[model samples]
Target: MELTAVHEHVWVIRGAVNMGLVRTQGDGLVAVDTGLDKQAGKTLEKAAKEIGLPLRAIVNTHAHADHFGGNAYLLSRTPVTVYAPEGEAAVIRRPMFEPEYLWQGASPLPQLQNKFLLAQASPVHVEYTPGVPFEVDGTTFLPVALPGHAAAQCGILVHDVCFAADAYFDPPVVDKHGVPYMVDYLATCRSADSLRSVQAAWFVPGHGEPARRPDAVIDYLKQRHEQAFQTVLAACRHPRSLDELLADVCRARNLAPANPGAYVLLRTPIAAYVTAAVGQGRMEIIMDGGKLQFLTIEK
Candidate 1:
């Protein structure tokens, strides 16, 4: 991975997942996030060393394995202090919380325990509050709450640059993942709306190229949420169980989850979408033949 300067002191290593770096006082680098695993951590450390900066600290945007999985490895090499949101701290300190949650709070299946969802345990030295500015070696980074994608995901801002970690995605990403995973569709929409007022010279997303304008990405995200919500409502014309409804949604999107991980990944978000629809009175639940099902509420 190669590190390119985004601003005077901000840099990003773009890959399947982007790792952000902020230059601190005295040639120190604070990683906005470390990528997937020990290998990813090694790559980030090497890239920082190439630029002549010692890795000093890590600010995990969320607890997702892919985003913070490299934390432990990086911490092992350089005893840097780790700062993360209060809500996500437990999951970071105990990697299994992620896969367990995906398994509906039961013991996660072996299929769900992979490094993609369960990262190495990393200590959280500081549990930060959202919208607070924290200082690291005389450089300040503003952590803005961007929930929904993950309940406690955040985007860090510094020097006219916004390191938006999975807050929003480009249109192509939306097109690729038809029913994009999210914890709460409404909260994600709210975060996208919040992005409207942020003026930055550069906006860097965890998944795509840096953009001067965040409008297009935010708009595309909103459109995808609406499309997914409508698809769920339409699929509920007849009373259908969650399983049947999810299958209908998958068929409509031309998606066939081929693995247990992919199945749960899609299932959780579909449930959120259904709950949102039902909460707004656009859909309703009923008991059918001893099975619980959802149906569109006649307007």
Candidate 2:
């Protein structure tokens, strides 16, 4: 992992998941987010030690495994307080909640318990209020609410650099994933709108290079979100069960959820689209032969 200085006090460890580091007054640092697993966390710890900065604390922007998976490892190495957003604190505290919720409150299958959905449980010392600035070891951080990618997800703002944790995907990542994962479509759009209004010198996404033009990035995300909504709507013109709709939408988008993990990941976002359409009165849910189905409303 390469640690590049993004601001006077902010440095980002660019890897599979971009982790942010903010130098404090002392020989300490506040890590914004950890990577996918314990090994990823160890990498960050090693890099920090090499730079003569010990991790004083960690601020997780969300509860997603990829964003906070390294929490357990980091804490194991050093005594550090972990801060997470209020709604996400519960999930971070009980990593199993992620897969449990993903499987709709039922016991998740082995495949669903992968690192993509479940991270090692980490204790949260503080449940931060979104949009509130808090101080840690003489450094200040504002947790900007940017929910939609995950429940109660927030972006960390420090030294004019906003570490946007999955608020939106980089254009290429969006293209690669085909269907971006989101729980609430409208909330995601609102979060994009919120990011557009952020006056930041630089913005760091969870999985992309830091952006100088956050507005442009948000614009692209908005367009993709709209397209996703339309795609799901078109797939529902003929009443179809959730499974059938998922298949048709995947086929139309040239997406293949080849594994159980990929299937569940894609299924959740598609379910979000159906919920958004129903909220807008553009679609309705019905029962067909003991199966739940969705049908597009005739305009």
List lDDT for all candidates, in order. 0.88, 0.89
Backbone clash tally (model 1)? 0
lDDT of 1 at 104: 88
Model 2 segments beyond 4 Å from truth? Answer: none
Q: Write the per-residue lDDT of candidate 2 for residues 240-261, one digit (tens) a residue.
A: 8999998998888899988888
Off by over 4 Å in 1: none
Q: What is the Cα-based TM-score of model 2?
A: 0.98
Model 1, range 196-232, lDDT digits (tens) per residue?
7887889888888888988988988898889888888
